[model samples]
Target: AQSVTQLDSHVSVSEGTPVLLRCNYSSSYSPSLFWYVQHPNKGLQLLLKYTSAATLVKGINGFEAEFKKSETSFHLTKPSAHMSDAAEYFCVVNPGTYKYIFGTGTRLKVLA
Candidate 1:
């Protein structure tokens, strides 16, 4: 199985606050990393990805991550957490397989 790690299983924040979702991974070959956001009863939305290109990858919804091979970490960060951001976040790795291996999954709660 591919290697992936989520530093937190849950994150709580107030609206308009900053958000960070930490992840670290290991792979035998080059890894394709993805950050997906899931709202309640909603499918996963691609937030960002790292494809062995640039170390720093920019993503939709003003999110970004830096791929660090030394530390093997790909952390998700947002300047401000919107109420809509209160959902589940998953850190996934593609190990050249059809099925995606997801992290434990993080639940984000936005406080008013």
Candidate 2:
């Protein structure tokens, strides 16, 4: 079985500052992890993914994550934050099954 846990329910950052959102997971085998962002009243958009390839994965808008199998973690980070980045982010895990386990989600609040 595989599951995802978003460590933070909410994260606030000022414009042009760095942003960090933590995530953890558990799986019986190698799992495919992904990040998705949902804007207000909009659909979810794929950010990045890790499927046993490179540990370091880059996404749109300068966001990136590193897969640490030893730590069972895949935390998202960005060098600078933007106002448009404010939204709900989710950590998902697919364990070679048809089911995709999604986290509770972390709402990012970018302040001016």
Candidate 3:
């Protein structure tokens, strides 16, 4: 079985500051990791993904995550934060079973 854990339930950042969202996972095999974002009342958007090709993967909107196999972690980071970046984020793990395990969620709040 595969599962994802998002360390934080909410993250608050000031506009223009760096952003970090932590995530951890447990899987039976090499897993596929993805980060998705959802704005209020909006559909989820794929931010980035790791499919066993690269340890470090970059995604849309200056977001990136590193696949740390040793730690079983894939933490998301962004160089700077923006007001528009406020949204709910999810960490997903696929263990090649065609079933995805989703993290609880982390809501990003960008403050002025």
Query: How far out, in Å, is residue 23 in model 3?
Result: 0.5
Q: Give one digit per residue, the lDDT tens place, for model 2 in 1-112.
A: 6789999999999999999999999999899999999999999999999999999999998999999999999999999999999999999999889889999999999999
Listed in order, each prediction's TM-score against the native is 0.92, 0.98, 0.98
**What is the C-alpha local distance difference test score of each model?**
0.89, 0.96, 0.96
What tens digits encode model 1's per-residue C-alpha lDDT throughout 2-111? 77889999999898988989998888777899999999898999999888899899999888999988998999988998887788999999977786778999999999
| Inter-residue clash pairs, candidate 1 | none
Which 10-residue window of candidate 1 scores lowest in summed lDDT?
93-102
Clashes of each: 0, 0, 0
Candidate 3, residue 28: Cα displacement in angstroms equals 1.0
* Deviation (Å) of 104 in candidate 1: 1.2
C-alpha RMSD of candidate 3? 0.6
- Least lDDT summed over 10 consecutive residues: which range in candidate 3? 93-102
